[model samples]
Target: MNKLRIGAATAAVLLALGTAAWSLRASGAGHTDASAPAPSVLTVEVIVPQQQSWPQSVQASGSITPWQEIIVSPETGGLRIAELLVDVGAVVKRGQLLARLADDSLQADLRKQQAAVAQAQANLYQAMSNLQRARMVDGSGALSAQKMEEYRIAEATSRASLDSARADLDSTRLKLSQTRIVAVDDGVVSSKSGVLGNVVAAGTELYRLVRQGKVEWRPELDARQVSTVHTGQSARLTLPGGEQVAGQVRLVAPTLSATTGRATVYVSLPAGAARAGMFANGTIELGAQPALTLPQSAIVMRDGRAYVYLVGSGSQVTSRAVSTGRRHGDRIEVLSGVDASARVVASGGAFLSDGARVTVASVGSAS
Candidate 1:
């Protein structure tokens, strides 16, 4: 009976061991299947390039100034300022009276000149009569030759004196006419340096005139940028209040400033609107060129280098180092690295690794 029990126990032990081995094998297989990486599911954005027209533009800043400026000064000296006709900020026409010198002394001098002229005329008439009388007497032999010669000499002297006096009178009259100050151009008076009752010297600046109510914007551009700007290019002016005025590039300096590496760009504003010394900003368009562009978010920086992930055949991710150009709005220009026909990942590119399989969630449309 003991041998029978031991045999039954041995048989039971073997059967239990076999069942445990089978169960362990099944669980190992299940774990192995669960650990095996299913194809990495990656979310990506794909972009296909399309050919389109793009414009290249350059931007710069500048200020506004008067197109022309003139300083009005006195032409003659030693005149007391009698009346000021125009004040600062006053609009004036060409040849309009701006001021007047004290004319009391000038008027007296003018009268003196007129009297001198009348006296010269009377003297000339007397000389003519004396010459005629002397000739008649000499012809009739009633007067000696020496006496006729003396009378002729006296008449010639009187005639020369009369001509000299007339010339002096005309000069004085011209000087008298210059005492009134007049505007040299059609403009506004920007400054006034003289006042009534003040004595001024010749050529002293009495008023400042800004011509034609126009202004010039002189923008400094770098030497490289100077070549892009040209005369007659369209320009727009921005003021402090965001007001914009249309203008045109009128002049470009041929030389560059050595100190600043810049050249002057001149723009002309319309009349009766822009004033001198007003601050202004402007922009000018250079020509256009072909370029490949991508959104700023599409570029990825890795290990101190700029790169972008490209989608290959079957949505495989590949990183490519790229050279970029200027930024246009939210997009940047691609100078090199990616070809036009390739699909580029636009978003979620940083999470991608080389040769990683990806599934594109959205395809970007070309602009």
Candidate 2:
């Protein structure tokens, strides 16, 4: 009976230990099943392309220049500049004196011409008296026909000499007036080449005037772009110092440059808006056009090409290459790629890959 009882105790102890081992194994398996991680999904915001009234424009870079540069030169030669009334950057009006030349010689010539006129008049009066006296003695043999002819010829000659002297006097007066250099039009002087007491010749440049103080922008464009631009188009430019100026197209070059294959488009700006020879960047307004645009953050650049992410039916994103156009503010023009109805990843596009699974964030969720 004791041996049988011991055998039963051993069997019961083994069965208890086996049951405990099985229970521990099942508990471990259950814990592992509950703690397993799920697949990762990137939460992102989505947007749809919309139609907006974006103004059409062409971007160009060029330099500022004077609209009309007038070269001021002396009309009379062999005269010295006695005084310079205007210097560089001096504003002047029409017919304003800019410089003065010595006029003493001209005044002296005027007096000499006047004295010659007086002598010629006196000779003319004597000849006229002789002719009159001869005519009174006609048919009386007091004067010969040849003598009367001589008196008439002398009177005509003296009258001609007097007219010549008057002409010389007028020329002298004109030269005297020319000694006073004056501005041709209202303008601001840009450069000065005349020096005080310096003798200058006729047609020599004395000063350079920016006519009307008007400045313009001259931007070069390719053959294709030149065809689209026309005169009277609205333009806006940013100066070198960040000042904005509005302007209008003044002229479009009829012919392109043979060497560079480019043409210049002239845009007229207001006076004092910008200085000549300044580099500027501007846009030519080409009217309004409907554009399908998206936020700039929605587009991503890779390998020099542009791309955008498109959401698919299965909550997955696929990258699509796109061609872009002009950019306005924070938005960019989508020339071709996805349709207007397609949902696109608005931001965080740089971190996304092709065919990546994504979770759409709620509209009111904090990004």
Candidate 3:
């Protein structure tokens, strides 16, 4: 009986010891599995920066206008419009007759004035003869002293009357010449405000002329940009159809616009290249600038911030913040946060994280 009880107790103790050992081993293995690091393996593209020559330029936009617009009006009034010699869009030379007023009245007035001039000349001749005779008779007492002085006064009065008639004739002739409305300069007629047989008043606008057929681009830019631009700077403008036209800066505004807080830059385009009222966008080349740039595909933006994936040894990548500048083509200028020699993930930055391990499956071509 004693031996049987001792054997049973020994068996129970041995079984308890085995069970505790198995539990301890299982718990230790679970802890070791839970604490182990996860594997981070990814395929990525890498890039090495290469310095290249690049041009620096600024963008601008504005409307095209005539180099000079002139207002054409008539000098004389109270006459009917008789003839419109040229129409809108007509090329005209200086002093070319654009329109004619009813000259019948003017011609009649001119003829009447000519007759008056002839009568004035006849009177002047008569006055001269009388003055000569008065001089010959003066102091000779051909008549009393009072009579001689009266003849001299009469001769002076006649001469003054003849001069007044001649002045009236000259005035009438000038009015006749003004009956024809002519161009003041060589230009293309842009607008016309004339009606045949309709009476027009003096100084009534007849036509609007674009002087010399030259067009200019007037680009509005911020004051800071205006300071860098100068006359003679070359620029290229893009038209509505994407046609690029070259132009040269002709003038820079001396003062900024008070309302818009911008300055105007006048760029002259090639003749017949553009017309007034054309809106265009352009870039002013500021010359070449040395820059450290990377492929545009390498940049990543998150939470309204710019980032880049920098690749280090062992294919480990770090998410780095970067400040970027101008963008040229597919590449962007890196102002800071990455050195020239830093290798970066060319693309697929969105899948990258800080301290992530990666492998260069394919390397991007050098830019």
- Each model's C-alpha lDDT? 0.81, 0.89, 0.86
State candidate 3's TM-score: 0.79
**Model 3 ranges off by over 4 Å:** 1-53, 144-151, 347-352, 356-365
The C-alpha stretches of model 1 lying farther than 4 A from their native spots are 1-42, 50-53, 141-167, 272-274, 278-281, 301-306, 350-353, 361-365
- TM-scores for the candidates: 0.81, 0.82, 0.79
Per model, state how many residue pairs clash: 1, 0, 0
Identify the superior model by lDDT, candidate 1 or candidate 2. 2
Q: Candidate 2: misplaced stretches above 4 Å?
A: 1-40, 131-149, 361-367
Task: Write one digit per residue (lDDT tens) for candidate 1, span 286-330.
Answer: 656777888878889888878988887777888999998777787
Flag the better candidate by lDDT, 2 or 3.
2
Model 1 score (lDDT): 0.81
Q: What residue pairs clash in candidate 1, if any at all?
A: 65-216
Candidate 3: Cα lDDT at 104: 88
Worst 10 residues of 3 by lDDT: 36-45
